[model samples]
Target: MPVPSISTKKLIPSIAGKLALAGGSLVFGSWVLSDIVHLPGGGAGLLALGAGVWWVTRPSKPASFSEPSSLPGWIRRCEAVLAQFSELELSLGLDGLRSSREQELDRLKALHEPLSVGVVVSEGGTHPTTSELQIALEGVHSLELCIAKPLPVVADAWSWPQELEELDVILYGLPMPLRAADLLRLEQLPTDRPAWLLIRDSVHQSREARQEALSCQLPKQWCDRLLFWSGESADLRQGLLPVRSHFVQPSRSREITKQRLLTSLHRRWQAELEQLRRERFRSLLQRSQWIVAGVVIASPVPSVDLLAVAVVNGLMVKDMAQIWGCSWSSEVLQVVARQLGTAALGQGVVEWSGQALLGMAKLDGGTWLAAGLIQGLSAAYLTRVVGASMADWMALNAGVAEPDLEDLKRQAPLLVAKAAERERLDLPGFADQAKEWLKSQRYAGA
Candidate 1:
């Protein structure tokens, strides 16, 4: 199975092309067509001029990759891995920042919309990540960002002021060993609204924060609703405890390995899908295309039990009928196709199918049931007749498992008679061929 790599390469140059074509056409036409068309060389020259003009007038390609930005080697590696896996960035250091510290702040600025910001900064321990904090606080619906910035690092945690002001949201990014004193200070703070507290460390640290709150004399809202988040550097398993979690590509080898494993699994999925297509669902694809192309054959020998579903998206079904082989009947086919997920199909099926089909060819599947039916019906005509290997692979591969022959028998009761007739006549491929011919030929006097 081919794993579809994230594409960083741009396919086309946008504009500046139209202008070139327009100019080329005028130049070629006037230069070659000087002589009258009534003469021989005149006509030839006219056509030649027109050709030259069009060629020269054609648009010139545009430049790519805008400019060269010096990115750190580690940063480049991070970008590559993040592109493979959806990554979230944390932003820290707001006092040093002039405006919203987003990567694309300028792009957002052009909208000229009033920004909604949530700032929670304190002078304390472990500083927040600049990228991660900014990204987490960004809310598209409210067009606001709720950031937490602590004050200068100080040994005395309780030295901070009692009631702060202008805080849309409160975020705490202190160290792992949280003390009971931290909760007392938080309670003293002015805001009764929601407060986002950072709780890094492992399982032990999370338990400490919950314990600290429980021991305090704070109100029910403060004790019960206080949000505890594992700090940015904490492990993922540790971080999942918080009600809301943000994921960023870790700048480490272990995280990169995890991303690659995910990619491999994705590829294996595609390989299985493709194997099913070649083995049993190819006919369904061809038939679906015929329907879309609106062509009907001379006779309807086998019924196409297709079920059409209207989804929010239409691009999901490009040669998707292969899914029907998962279970026979157009109805089953359509359902599975829709279930494949629109997110997966955005990158094109053939490429993904090859990736998924690579290893799946080795796996045992019910898809052969459909192909077996096809072969069984085709056997009626021999001597330059159709053939199918429904049960032949396990015959040679030795390692292949025989499906419950009883279950295969139970799948399609009516098709059994058609298959037996073809098998007795020694032309097992007839069923598929007959269907194909039926779809391809047009009825003359319908």
Candidate 2:
């Protein structure tokens, strides 16, 4: 039988940390207010306490996954698969998928191609690898797994991948595991399995190892089938899909809730925002972009980079930029060069560049990079742009009037700054020429 997994549970600490920080901030604020007027008990103790709480709950790792021992064997099997690798690589397969799963499947699909990579597990029993195959097909990935009659799942930890042919699992109440240890021991096991072992985890090896053990026990028939492509050949591509139990998204409710929450939150935040310094805001956005871009390039964590940039830059996380750029009008200008002549992303994407500067002057400061270059950007691109163009597009898409772009001008300092800044991007342009063009534009802005 196939195994089951769970949603990543290690990330809980991050949420707790945020809550702790908020609680600390409240206490710190009260302490500050009291101290100002020489309250009888005002002191730094409360501030320290608050800081401690923030320190504790701030998310340090992904959520933890703790399984109940009494849960069904299938569920336990799933957890073992996921704990094998980073959540990004382990795909939660079918036989356990819920409704409206396509949205999630697509997101995973967008991240990586499957045919180019494969995971094959030829269990020695009658387990329907096909069922698992269907689940994985959602992402256009394939795996090679061996299967046979059913059997009891053991908690054994010593079952190495090479000797799993002796495992106790029976696909259909069969007599014993179709042992493949001989093939493995002789080193005669075809080199092309491209498969990961799905088994129980102990102190040393993971559940993937267990699965590997099971594979080693396969019957000659199935074993021989794999032997054809077992040789190390470039044409036979295989990869491991560490299985896991994770919830897919693009959920309508999640979308609505996130949108509404951000809208209200940003709106309430604007009161304080009105007093916020432009340069300070610019610095924050720049820092945010660097961090996010760094993550996008450096890690497979997710799309948090673009979203994080939006949050720090005071832009609406979900709203169309053309409609919401007004909210950020004072700090940035966003231009979105769509892939198609229209917004439809059919063929692929082209390129886009954004420049940030001050009145007719190109500005550069510590860690403040004001320009960005984007190549082959996708729908994900629209996500990072901010300013008038964003607001225009959002408003246009939302069926609202294009807010006044009337009387806007290239402020000489900002224009000059933006122009000179252009040279800093990954493009072929001289700073002087870009500067001259920006300076000459009439300062007719919304």
lDDT of each: 0.34, 0.31
Report the C-alpha lDDT of model 2 over 343-390, residue by residue, as the tens digit: 212211112232223222352232223233121111123222332123
Ten-residue segment with the worst summed lDDT in candidate 1? 379-388
lDDT tens digits, residue span 142-171, model 1: 334444445544436554432333223345
Error of 1 at 429 (Å): 99
Relative to the unseen true structure, what is the C-alpha lDDT of residue 326 in candidate 2, on a scale of 0 to 100?
31
Quick one: best lDDT, which candidate? Answer: 1
